[model samples]
Target: MEIVEFGSDDSGLVARFVDVSNAVRRHDAPWQHLQTVHAATGMLRHGWDGEPAVPFLATHGGDDVAAGEWHVGNYDNLHIAWLTVDVHPAFRRRGHGTELLEALVDRTRSAGRTSVGGDGWDNELSRSFAARHGFEQKAVEVNRRQLLAEVDPALVDRLHAEAAAVAASYELVRCPARTPDDQLPVMAEMVSAINDAPIDDLDIEDEVFNAERVRAYEEAHAGRGITLHRLVARHRETGELAGQTVIGVDRERPHLGNQHDTSVVRAHRGHRLGLLLKTGMLQWLREVEPQIEEIDTWNAESNNFMIDVNEMLGYRIVGRALAFQKSLA
Candidate 1:
């Protein structure tokens, strides 16, 4: 088998990789995974807006075998943003996946990066592959979904009112545009604090969420088809970006139509801005995509605060995953 550098930005290559990756994803993740992949891939390719992305291809027996992707982002450690191998259903036991993975390891060492990162669901093959790669299990990214059709409107309304009453001075807007480019510095610092906010057992090395990375995320992750429903909490007295929550809705969901990211700035933690933004985002979801049956989200397993807010909003844990990693050196 020959391992090669094909690069992730090649549209044809990306499409081909998606063909296999999506197939495996179908067998593994919910339909929303495709949308997230589509969105992230687009961002990852948006003029390299994300961290540097490297793609490697594997081929043998005159057939396309697999591809691996690495994204060098804000983490002090160079991370393997994605790695997927498609052993033709016919080629499963022939050890093609193992060979490609070994090759990826060699490449990482040559590149001078410290580690690799990727997430996988709680499945036997996934867990086994991670273990075989010299990776230890890390945090579980809890995936949750709430069906709009079954939502308790009275409860939602009550929470909405209560959250709003407490956060009365702030206004809600639906796009990242409301977040000014100038405030990128403050936005970066605030997000950095939150990124550095308490989480259990993550090998995070530095607080790297900054202005450039935030905008790069915009160009790379939250692109056009996916709209960012961002509600910023401005200090009533200071008018600074004290708190914010952002949700993403992809019109592409097969059954359930939206997914969201909700966060509240640390300083505004006690004022229930988290509650306000979540309730506001739910309200927006209800009005705009009433057809959307549910929305999914992920949070650190140890994140009691966000998890509690989600629980109050009727979100339930649907599945769990491990973010596995290994040091390159």
Candidate 2:
């Protein structure tokens, strides 16, 4: 087996990578959308927040067998690297996955990272593989999806109205596409509220967010051809941003949407802002992105607050994933 790193410019290799990814998705997560070449290229080039991962393709006997990437954060979690390994369904049990993982671990250690983390669908195969590799399960996450066709407008209206009444002191502000330059500062501050979410014993640090980081995030999404629809709640009197919810709609696949982050500042909790923000987003998307069919989101199993809100909005559990970590030290 041979492993070689490839850049975004190498369209041939990128397409091969997407092929393996789609193959794995079909076998492992048939309900999930397939990956497109354009989206994969953008991800390889722009990454999540302008920090692209180092992607590698493994080939055996002139046939592509596995794909992997190692991602390290520049702003926070500086001591750890996140890894992903996807083996072609037809090529599994041939030691391709393990070999690719070994290469990723080597790169992680060479990057001076003390810990490495990876996540996979909850299954005996995934669990035993991690355990055999000396990794410990640290957290569990539930993936829930909302199908627009099944949502009740009457329910959404009632919830939004109830939340609005309770949060009468605040107003919802619609921010479509990219955030304005003037709002980056406040957006950064409010985005940091995600730090309050449950980590479930994962060895990580609070992500540092600022104006620059916010800009980078918007740009990265734009580069991936995703239109960002963000709804923020602001205090009526003080005009401070209290909470926000963001959804990204894919341009290439207009029927698909992703739930980004929904958070409220610690001082502003207990006002039903979470419900207000999410319900407001649903209403706003109805008008702007009626083409969207399904939206997916993930939450730590321990985050009952957010899960309750999601469930109330008709989000149903689609799958569960396990996060595993290994200390390189």
C-alpha RMSD by candidate, in order: 3.3, 0.9
Model 2 TM-score is: 0.98
Q: Which parts of model 1 are misplaced by more than 4 Å?
A: 7-11, 30-44, 47-49, 74-90, 168-178, 197-199, 221-224, 251-260, 288-291
TM-scores of the models, in the given order? Answer: 0.83, 0.98
**Off by more than 4 A, model 2:** none
lDDT of 2 by residue, 25-119 (tens): 89988877899999999999998889999889999998999999989989999999999999998998889999999989999888899999999
lDDT per residue (tens digit) for residues 85-118 in model 1? 4454445667788898777666666766667667
Error of 1 at 111 (Å): 2.0
lDDT of 1: 0.66
